[model samples]
Target: MNTTQELTLFDNESEVELFKHKITLEKIKNELINFGLTSNQSKVFIYLGKYGSKTASEIAKALQLPRTETYHLVNSLQNMGLVTAELSHPTKYTSLEMKKAIATLVKQEQQRIEYLAGKEESLSQMWNELPFFVVETDESKSEKMQLLHGLAAITNKIKEMVGSSTENIRVFGSMADVLRLYHSDVFDWIDNAPTELKMVISPMTKKPEFVSDLDQDKIRSLVSGSDKKCFVINDSKEILIFMRNANHPTRQTFAWWSDSETLVEMMSMLFDLSWEKGEMV
Candidate 1:
């Protein structure tokens, strides 16, 4: 840890947004790459920003970039006025002036947003002629919807019906719970848990390789680590399975989760028999 670490702790939106691009397997790492900074340059800056002030050696170790290459980047950030060297003892560089760096990023983003907004506005205006109903919700209904906005209510309802399910949750459809509903931290909790996970993927999902040869791995790991540690039962009992949008709670989109024992048990039985047959690929 060093100067970069110090600044990165304050890593506001833009820095965080960098990694958001390649989160899904749908996109590759290059898709997240920015032309403004070389991968090494970005790595060094990101490391220093996240790790705080650090010696060149620390930056190299933390970023796992080669020492000689790191020195090149250190020189580059300094030349670009993005990083400053400390005068005292062990000699470290920092990138604490996030205001400028982030502002530069924001300016570019603003220009892009402006362009997109202009296009969107034009499209909306053109589509104005399309017949659409303006269903004005009564104040009472709006207030009721607001009260039920919490997904905890949805999950809580499932829990109430099934009673604390010890079995792993079987999920179908795309990663609705994660992409649409919960934060990564909460998903991590679900993923790392001993709960079983069985997914009958929807056509909307791109099935990853090795799904049915020996050990099928999907609908997990995208959130948590360690594939083998999971209990993955097909046909879950007391688990909610639905085709809901992950962002529904926020977007006010409606979704449903079934708490039926019949569905859960059937899924569980299929999972057990498949496990014996090496259906997991």
Candidate 2:
């Protein structure tokens, strides 16, 4: 082949290799996240693993992270025994081998689970010792609505709804909303809930890993056009509708929740229609 054609061929091959490398990196990062490291922490650990020891400034520059954040990540990783720091002129950091790192994370997680399990009985006893009372009023019979601001409040409300649901629960939303719920442990709550669950997600979004763990018959993807709207209907008695802009940050997000018969009925109808239109997962 001529020089130009040969160079073009080489460029194409280089691009393909680069793409493959990126995919591999992403896979590693995801596995690291699954092992309990945050996204940035995974990235930092992978960088150190691949590039060997690096000074904090070098790591920050290489990863394009803020210097302060990089230092914090390194310190956290060191404390977790996944990264080590050397007492050199410029302190350098090194990641534990991938196998050892995984073992360390697994041990930490096991310790955490055991600690919680050990405290469960005492915690339950303490909780039971606290008396609970409910004041009955005319207001209690009336419909109620609550505006939840911020992700923490929204997550807690969803958890409460899931925990209280007894019959059926339906979730219809954009994939981003579903992912947010998963990250907030709402999925875990739902998994342990006694209620039946049905979910419909936007057609264009890729299925998430957690989808495979759920009943295939209960979850589906909308085959028609998609939108950013999201809502959850619990036992046809209440609804929570996301009101925040999809592109906005989580801190600025908010949701509307209501137990009004009219509102709940309307959202239930919408969810039913969406479920009918959804394609099996």
Candidate 3:
């Protein structure tokens, strides 16, 4: 009707019809499995779906497939119950009734879903049965000790060792060593601490007003923290020890996430006893 506009279909009903035609073609091209129906059979189904029933010769001419190939595809589709012969003068091939075809497809989908659910359950059981594993290292003590360093490095060690952990952790820091650097990133971490945090501040923090809310409220104070030779030990298997004081930013530290129950217990006992004598605020 709009022939005066050069017949470009993009902004009109012609474009909408074109897209709908493409979507229907894609849906009908069911290459469901290999070693199965040939392309001609698929096209015959689509042809029947679009143009209705047609004789073998008529289909061959419409699809441009060899007469012999069309015969083979029609025979295959007939066996699969997807195409049926209509008893007429020349005989016509028709795609199976749509309702029956859709029922078969739904059954196939249900079987596939059940198979996947069983597979996932089996995998979950296997994963749950796997034992915890540890990778071994032969690094020298000096090399291992040199790994921890700086504010970022040290705080990460604390988070890993104490975050969400139910056990008490030892954070031994020199009060003077952390005065200015206290609120930097370290206190931020302490504010959102996960588990119990037992601090061993150098006798410098005599008042509770100076520390973070988490530390001031939950912290158990005592002597012997990371300050003099700053170190944090959680249950023996995990230890974060400073190489030197905080005056210089370059002094590195060490973190040992070990599984030494004896070491953790001893350090925890010392902190517990000292905390008994310490005061909050």
Candidate 4:
């Protein structure tokens, strides 16, 4: 039998096998650390795993860790379902099957994910209310008229204007555009009504009673003599105008939005005139 000075074990087949097992344990310990286990916990788990059942004091001596710390680590691992203890006099701790132990940790992570998913909507509402987010359209920034094209951008702009409207919301639009707003839940703000909504629908379009919760008196609509889709919010603070493009074979939509007081006033006056001419629905 022969061995190199630096090599701890290598004289024969049995010693080489023992060294291989030690190497395997070290690899497993590193893997456990990567799985979010503390260094001490990974070392203790590896020791218990390799040696099968062992007393806490023995494990501490083998790992050169303090007895008290080793005991605490064992208890944590046990609570995490990675280790189990025998009820005998000097309790012996043994690592659970590696596959089952990892499965338990994965299950815990999944549960946390589901919990966060359930709270996302409420958390998003709270985040929106937080003061840290800057308001994009400040009244003082008069030149900040935002041009919005496409149905989605225009719909969102309308929702934002309606959501922040304080005194009144006057709408002039085709029945289809109004229906799109209703289905998208933009009319949800009407639940907090008393902020009067005077609407005018295109004479060629059919009217629909959109939201059931809003006070019908607060939402008065009439048939418009002319056809155009536009809305003004809070006495000319903001305005969104939709331009119909019936020429598009695909029937695509487009719109313009602005918070400029000048633009809003012009749009508001037009909406008022449309409302006056419209026959009450």
TM-scores of the models, in the order given: 0.28, 0.52, 0.39, 0.44
How much does each candidate deviate from the true structure in C-alpha RMSD? Answer: 17.7, 9.3, 19.5, 17.7
Lowest summed lDDT over 10 consecutive residues: which window, candidate 3? 2-11
Per-residue lDDT over 1-281 for candidate 4, one digit per residue giving the tens place of the 0 to 100 score: 22231133222334444565666656676677756699889877766775689898878776678999988999999888899999887999999878988898888778888999999999999988887755767654555666666566676776677677777777665666566667766666654555667666665345465533555454445543444544546546777666652222112667666677787777777766766666545
lDDT of 1 by residue, 1-281 (tens): 34444333323435543334324411221222332567667667766775578998877776666889888989877876678899967779998455787576567668887999889978998899799777766743331111223455554443343234456555443334433323423334445555544444332234343343213563323332222221222224344433334534333433344435665577567545434433222
* Whole-model lDDT per candidate: 0.50, 0.82, 0.60, 0.67
Number of the predicted model whose lDDT against the real structure is largest: 2
Predicted candidate 2 versus true structure: per-residue lDDT over 39-118, tens digit per residue: 98998898789778999898877677899999999999998999998889799999999999999999999999899999
Question: Could you tell me how far off, in angstroms, the CA of residue 196 lies in candidate 3 after the best superposition?
Answer: 2.8
- Estimate, for each residue in 33-63, the C-alpha lDDT of model 3 and write its tens digit: 2224455566677666655788888777766
Q: Which predicted model would earn the best TM-score?
A: 2
Q: Candidate 2: list runs displaced more than 4 Å.
A: 1-140
Residue 263, candidate 1: Cα error in Å is 4.2
Which stretches of candidate 3 lie above 4 Å from their native place?
1-146, 177-181, 205-209, 215-217, 220-227, 235-237, 251-257
- Candidate 2 colliding pairs: none
